[model samples]
Target: MRRALGVVALGVLVTGCVGPRPAAPVATAIVAPPAWRTALGPGSPVRAEWWNAFGDPVLTRLVAEALANNPDLGIAAGRVDEARAAERLARAQLSPTVSVGVPTTDSRALNAFGTASTNLTATPSITASYDPDLFGRLRNASAAARAQLLASEGARDVVRLAIASSVASGYITLRALDARLAVARDTLAARGDALRIARRRAETGYTSNLELHQAEGEYRATEQLIPQAQLAITRQEDALSLLLGATPRAIGRGAALTALVLPPIPDGLPADLLRRRPDLFQAEQTLVAADRSLDSARAALLPNIALTGSAGVILTTALANPVGIFSLGGSVLSPLFDGGRLRANVDLTVARRDQAAFSYRRSALTAFREVDDSLAGVQRSGEQAVAIRGQRDAYAAALRNASNRYRAGYSSYLDQLDTQRGLLTAELALVQANADRLTSYVALYQAMGGGWTEADVAAVRR
Candidate 1:
């Protein structure tokens, strides 16, 4: 029960617990503007487990392997655990503190009674203190700690997302090199056949020696591309191995470039987009921390109220006498002034909070831009792939016709070689198209805030 005495002997009575105020506008702005930037497909169901969409069991295994063993991710996870421990420590500050102590003393005393005596006393005491949370300092500190914890967990999820993306990008690059190499080898073989035919015709005076030499030149050039492609493939393999937290070693190749399954990207709702991103969430948490720290600093200006109490037992015994004792006390503190220190601290906290708020806003804008860029890239690449496919098919048919005409002695062999070169270029373009599509898939997933969820952040709180 509680009663308040007002001016002129007016009085009021109140009952029940007083609670926290309605949260501030800053707290409400944790996520502002429903659509961070136009959600991809409103109501589209994003797969909770995104990596599984690739459907390559080996890729899934490799991603899992890296997540478990990669040192970078391990370090990130450890930081999350550290933040959680700090949060618990901060929370403990909200409770009363009690300490137990014991002291003993002995003294030699001489009195006018004509006898000298030694007196010994043992004092065992327990002191308990509570700040009473009159100003909520401990509570504010705890809020900062909790906010820090969320940010740390967000960092961990960011690392996890990067690892998965690196693996996928490496896989795509390696396979694209593979396709290019194969095309180069096929071109070399065709050039070899043409060169031999040219040599025979030149020896019989049916084709000029200059034509034979040109065919030989083209064949060797195609041969040169093979080594270059192989070198690139090796370098890419080394990079992927490092991402997998391994030394340079042959990696298990999964699906072929053409067979790689692109995951379905769901454009979640605008509100969902605002909430799904880890960096955005992290920024918001940091802002909350700053806000609480500001409150803590502001509270410092108020008079500090402490309720301290000590209860103890004391014993003294002589040859014929004994004494038992007990005591209790409390304390209160008030700050007169501090040469503007309190105000300065409050100002500093406010500045930090402003910085945090600005960072959060910028992060949200960047996230929206990334999603837009990824979507545009996917749209253009898909259309370009369609157009390129038609071009490739037409060039292939032309090359076939030219080869048949030359073999029947109705057209020059050079015509067949030129058309084959065109066909080769077209085939490589298809490989490029496949790679572009796969990259788009990866980008889409990454833009969706590294697949972070509220539950993941909550887990780190443990």
Candidate 2:
């Protein structure tokens, strides 16, 4: 026993000197910019339920339904559960395991005097074993699993934010299509009246057949727009239904395209994006998991210590009394030789950690670009909508003037047709511009993480 103890002490001392070295700390590749390229004015902080900021109850309700039923969210949740289980498994390795076992035997055997004898024997034992984690291997593994759990949770949030944004943007587009259809129908009605007036003038010799034909052709052109708009609306509704995780069907509307309130610009700094965006948070956590895993892999190069003990009683029918038995022992396994498997694992983990670092950098850069792009979209689209509205008003006035001049025979019917076409074009363009402006707000909200915070992930971990 003294020799065994001396050997163990010597081995431990020798292995400790050659244990795995700590890896160099990885630094983030990209730094956050001081400010956004497109400067935004002061605005409210992002809301947890950012979709509700649009002040449309229907849009809010749809987003709620989608969040509750989206299959992608279900998958993400399953991954979180899996990560939690993995964390538990890793943690279990740090603790001792106890088990009970029983063995029984019945047999007939010849005794020392050559007489045949029947006997039964039974041994029941309680055994325990543990890995002392002398090298911090199990702890690093548990930490890696914990980080992965947080990453999975962040991924779930990313899916949720995306779903909300998609629903809001789709709803806005549907309303825009509705507004365009309304415009087409209204223009078609006006064209019908003009065609009637032209027929009357042609029959009474007040206008020629050329004017009558032009009115009929313009009326047909406006009429075709109605069906085209209807087709587009149907497709948009179907697309929204898919987002809602329902069968293709009509979507409820609470506000017109022009009436839907524009959500406030979500306020966030570039640095804040690291914590505000779930994707970025997920990426960072993934990097953490990889780093911890690398630590575990490096620890694998060191010795593993295990302690085991068992206590039991053996009973035999031939014996006069039961025999007591007990054992306690420990082992140290140091990797003296392997075809480079342990070293290769360390290298593999290093590569994975580096990949995670670069991926996090890419996600951060993407988030910055998205925020700037959405800001530009919101500002530029708003400007375009304003200009288009002014143009629509001018076209409306010109159409009225053109119609009156044609009625008074001061201009040809073609002049009125030209003004009507311009007015219709401007009205359609205005609807699109409004939708673009609203959807840009949606994009900005999504880019700003839709009010997600690191605390949300912390709460889940707790």
Candidate 3:
């Protein structure tokens, strides 16, 4: 028996010298551009609280509220907590386990004398077991769990960035609707004055019924716009309320759409996106976890070594004094044959690791595209707003000339009506263009990662 045990121990020692396979190499296929296609030289660094750049206290407050109370964020936090617990469990595997137990028994039996007697036995023991990690399997598993924890944290930050962006964009739309409503009401009031003037001219016989009817029709056409604008405002308010995670209700007003500050474009190179975006960070961490998991699976093929020990005190009705007992043992469980189950596990981990690598590549490419798209939007929208503003000014001047010509009997009412229509259309277009410009900035900020960084995550972890 001793010779056989020595041979087994020798084989285990030899196997232990050959450790787990080295980690496989993973590579990302995507490449970032040298510079942004719409690069506007260096600008201000993106602030962590990017919404503050808009200089609207109400908008800032809304974003804060959404971050704190949003259900999606809460769910994300819960996932993070779960990951933390899993990490703890994995780490526990690296340490020895100790337990204590007490057991008591009573029995009645006939002895040699044929006498029935009751005897009670009580045994209390403390045991300890340890896995001497000769192959680093437990260490790799612990590392994998730690990587998963970081990935969960990154996912949480991604949700946080998304919620802030949504709140800002929703607020911008609400304010634009407010501006449209104001323009509609102002135009209706002006048309009402023109209708009164035409009535007086017709009664004095200075104008024909054709001119009087035309003015009244124009006034009514403008009147309908007020109701349309009000309806849109109500819908927009409700939408903003939802983003605030509150029941549909009236939203408070802040700076007018035109008065709101246009934040400076955030500046960063395309390659920086890898570290700036939380989604990208999450993807990278997921890959790391897969790599560690693969290592652990490979390590499973090696021999497992365990050491166990126990110490106990026994008390019995027949014993004169308490008895002490102790035991020590060691084991080696090497997978000599398992129908290739261990190798199959390694293959499965390899496949999953490759999948994670591809996922990371996809995420990096997507981040690059989003930044480029947002940059173009910010530039093109600003240019459109400029052109629309100039057009609005020209239409306003023409309306003044047309109104005077009709009142002085030099032109027909049709000429005044055409100019009025052009001016109103220009005003509405200008409002939309301005709103688009502001919202483009919001998209740019979001696409640029909303000032999220891997360093921030590390700081929180610490």
- lDDT score, residue 180, model 3? 85
lDDT of 3 at 362: 87
Per-candidate TM vs. native?
A: 0.81, 0.85, 0.82
Candidate 1 regions off by >4 Å?
1-47, 109-116, 265-271, 318-327, 407-414, 450-462
lDDT, candidate 1, 1-462, per-residue tens? 000101000242344964332221122212212221212233322235555677776666666666666789779879988999999999998888999988888988889997999878877888888877788887898999998988887767677777877887778888899999999998888889888888998999987898789889888888999999988887887787677666565666668887878665443323344355666777888999999988888887777777777777666665344344555555666677679888899999999999999998888777766666666677777888888889889988998898789768899867887887788888889889878877877776687664434444343334
Q: Summarize candidate 3's per-residue lDDT along 396-419 as a digit string, tens digits.
A: 898899889988989988888888
TM-score of 1: 0.81
Clashing pairs in 1: 41-267
How much lDDT does each candidate structure score? 0.73, 0.79, 0.78
What's the lDDT of the predicted structure labeled candidate 1? Answer: 0.73
Top candidate when judged by TM-score against the true structure: 2
Off by over 4 Å in 3: 1-47, 201-214, 266-270, 336-340, 452-462
Predicted candidate 2 versus true structure: per-residue lDDT over 1-462, tens digit per residue: 111111111223334353342231222232212221111112322335667678887777787777766778789889989999999998898889999999999999887999998899999999999998887889999999998988888888788778888989999998998999899999999999999999999999997899899989998888888889888877887787777666566677788887788755423333443346778878988999999999999999999989999999999998999999999999999999999999999999999999999999888778777777777888899999999999999999999999999999899888898899889989999998999999988987787777433444344234
Q: Which pairs, if any, clash in model 2?
A: none
Query: Lowest summed lDDT over 10 consecutive residues: which window, candidate 2?
Result: 1-10
Ranking by lDDT: 2, 3, 1
Off by over 4 Å in 2: 1-47, 111-115, 266-270, 452-462
